[model samples]
Target chain A: MKQKNKKVNYSKWGYIFILPFFLTFFIFSFIPLVDTIRYSFFQYFRSGLKWIGPNFVGLENYKSLLQSDMLRYAGNTFILWIIGFVPQIVISLLLASWFVDARLKIKGQQFFKVVIYMPNLIMASAFAMLFFALFSLKGPINSILISWGVITETTPIDFMGTALGTRSLVGVMNFLMWFGNTTIMLMAAIMGISPDIFEASEIDGCNSFQRFFRITLPLIRPILAYTLITSIIGGLQMFDVPQILTNGAGSPNRTSYTLIMFLNDHLKSKNYGMAGALSVYLFVVSGILCYITYKITNDDDPDGSKAAARKRKKMERRMK
Target chain B: MESKGYNRFRVIFAHVLLIILSFLCLFFFYILIVNATRPHAEIQKGFSILPGGYLVTNFKNMISDGTYPIVSGVINSIIVAGCSAALCTYFSALTAYGLYAYDFKLKKVAFTFIMAILVMPTQVTAMGFLRLITKMNMDDTLFPLIIPSIASPAVFYFMYSYLQSSLPLSLVEAARIDGSREFRTFNQIVLPIMKPAMAVQAIFTFVGSWNNYFVPALVLETKSKMTVPVIIALLRGADYMNRDMGKMYMMIATAILPIIVVYLFLSKYIIAGVALGGVKG
Candidate 1:
């Protein structure tokens, strides 16, 4: 009886303690989410200020997104994602491996680490401004190229003016914005590998490259997968860089336009219904991509006695 | 013996490569700093590696022009960031502690809710949130800016994981046996022990709040209430294309100074916090 009373008292306190978060989450997060779904189906106008009726536009918004020029925007986003995500992971892994290798006693390791990570702290707007100044046609980059006689004096290369050039510029922005964070995460993964494995590999006469490929990469494969999946989701949701760099116009004939920017444009145009549809589309696409990535990586642990037994056998063999 | 020589070469090559990458990073920083100091003509003349002497003049112009409020925006940013961080950290700790210490049927459900919410990007529900705020007449106030952040799903998840891994259940059991109420126990015991996680979360929350632009841009219409990112973006639009390069660079420099200063001082915590947040996410 006393224990039951204690349990009741504890449960009541738990409710009280968690009330603030639950209340705030419902008001701020969950309700809005429900409303977003509801608004996506209705036709909203600027003057109505009311959500009209229960107009069921079941698949119309999705159809429009599929047929609209927004598909081009999605393709551009994927291009940026490929350019950014692939190199980011590769370069970050290389850096991480180099930092951890026992053979290389690089100077100012900590300083370099801190410096690389500094950009991550700056607001995206500020980072965009810095890059804008650097990449402007009359900016230092072009001037330097001209002074060095690398290019003819007549034609100045416009970094943000061309389609491919603008895409690559956005790629550079993506690289700079995220590489530091990746390096840091990759570094943690590298550090987590037990020294025993490295020692054993050394005893077996594995060189740095060999060891990295055979041991380190496989060991950190999980972290790499995690980074890749997250970066993909983040890349798909790319907005701020293009938003600020292109001054929210998506620049150079919307070549730098992302799905989020497209959504924002719809919202600004007071087409909340279409905007909601676009957001839901993005959400679904991201979800599907995340699922595909997980499947490709095979990161999920399988259930059932057979799978568990197979895992135990493998562990025993590895232990030997 | 040949392999040893090759290994030495490889080490040299790696260092050289890393050095180049580091230089690239520093080069960008140099560009920002130099641009902050140089005259508009020099800035437009392409990249100037050297700092010019117009920094003071630029600063005076930027401040006096009212395009960027160095003083007011910083104060406003501090208030918003500080309040959000405190509330977020406190509530996250509370929820995490509640979930950690208690055994209830809702435990699994609550944890799943937090994780599910984590996957929903802010943009997905932003329209709904805006509408709700407009109806509540909280559209123009800082309440919209600071309130939603208080229940950050990411922070809650972080606190939950930290509580699970680092905190021992014995501590909670002992406090409960001593007849302490749950809230008091958490306040007196659990919180003091969770200082490292709290410190890390506080800095992360503060930085995120400070650097936030989109939500604030959509919500706060007034200039005075604008955070640093919004103010800086607006200043860029008004000053940069308008040929007020002096004010533009000045605003940019002043806007970035707080983050740079904070980062320079608390880089270790910030890096750790970022790593933790990344891993949790």
Candidate 2:
């Protein structure tokens, strides 16, 4: 009984230590999330003062979201995600593989790592301005392209105006912004593999490429899956680059407008109901995509599963 | 002998490819710095590798007339980032200590809640959060920008994992037996040992807050209250055609300076933190 009391006292102190986070999380995160969903179903009126009253719209906002221009915005977001995320992962893996290769024998590899990582720290607004300077019709890139006679005076690249043009712009920006960070993460995962595996592969006369494909890729599959899912989720929700570069209207016929941008506009226009519905839509879509990605990438290790089952059976025997 | 020759050729090819890619990466940054120095006309006309003499003039123009409230924005950015980092570090550390020390029935549930919120993008609650701020009469203030970020679940998740690995329960028990209160034990005992984790969290929180554009843009409408990123956005928009090119370059340079300075100082912490955070997440 005395020991029980002491244990309770210890737990009480633990609770006391954690109370601040719980208080703040409840007030800031959980409450706002609940309020967001709740207010989506109501009519928010602002005649005298803002008031949220239950109107039982019965999925009116969600229904309207489906029929609204949001579908177009969603399509744009999907395109951006593919352009941004797919190439990002590929480039990252390629770079990581190259960095790990023995033949490169690169000096100051850490210096290169730092240089690539620096861009990710820059503000999106600054990056946008930098790109605007670089990609403008009269900018140096165009001048260089023209000087090389790649295009005649009659033809100029309108990088920020056309669908393909904006996609390329954002794609490049996303790649530059993300590739370094992804490379570092992948490098860490690669480094985690036991050196004995490499020795074994070499003993078997496996070449570097073959060893990487067979041993390295398979061993780091979980990490790759993790990176892919997070990148997809982040890419789908991209806003700052498009918002800043396109002046908040999503550039050249809204070709660059992501779903988040669309949602922001709805909120700014005081269509809170629609904004809430859109948020819910993004949440659901991202959740579903994450699920699908997890399912597709999941690998079943037969030996590992059998080992786990044997360990469980042994534990049960000890308990008995 | 033929295979040896082939291997040598492959090695050379790999090094050449790597060198080219490295140069490509360096070229973009070179463009940024060169553009910062050159006159807008020269920049528009063609690439110039050497530094020009327009940097001081640009700096003066940017300080005098640029849309960004450069000095005040810097101060506001520092305050917001500094306060948010301190608050987030303390709260997250405290939560992590509690969760790890106790064997409560709701431990799994509480942890799941933290993980769930970590993945939920702030955009999902932006509208409601905005309304909540307006209702509290806190709109357009730096308070809204700083206070809400203090409850970052990502930081809590980091702290949780860090505490599990680095902290032991014996220290807490010893402090308790010495008649130290829970808060005192945490402040005096736990915090000192958690410096590595704290440094990483602080750097991440500071850089994140410093680079944040969306929440600040939405919440702070007043020019005086604008954060650095928001000010940079405004400068980019304030007459792109007839804009003071010198001032524009200066604003861009100023906007990037703080982050670069901080990153230079805290890069070691940043890298370690990123590595650790990546492991658990």
Which candidate leads the pack in lDDT? 1
What is the i-RMS of every prediction?
Answer: 2.9, 3.1
| TM-scores for candidates 1 onward, in order | 0.91, 0.90
Query: Tens digits of per-residue lDDT for model 2 on B65-147?
Result: 63567878888999999999999998888888888877666777876666655656777878888888899899999998877
lDDT of 1 by residue, B9-82 (tens): 87788778777777877777776677778777767656666789988887777767665566677788899999
* Chain A TM-score, prediction 1: 0.86
- Provide the clashing-pair count of each candidate structure: 3, 0
The residue-by-residue lDDT of candidate 1 on A157-189, one tens digit each, is 888888888788778778877788999888887
Runs in model 1 deviating more than 4 A are A1-8, A47-56, A287-320, B45-47, B67-70, B236-242, B277-281
Top of the candidates by DockQ: 1
Candidate 1 has a DockQ of 0.53
Model 2: chain A TM-score against the true structure? 0.85
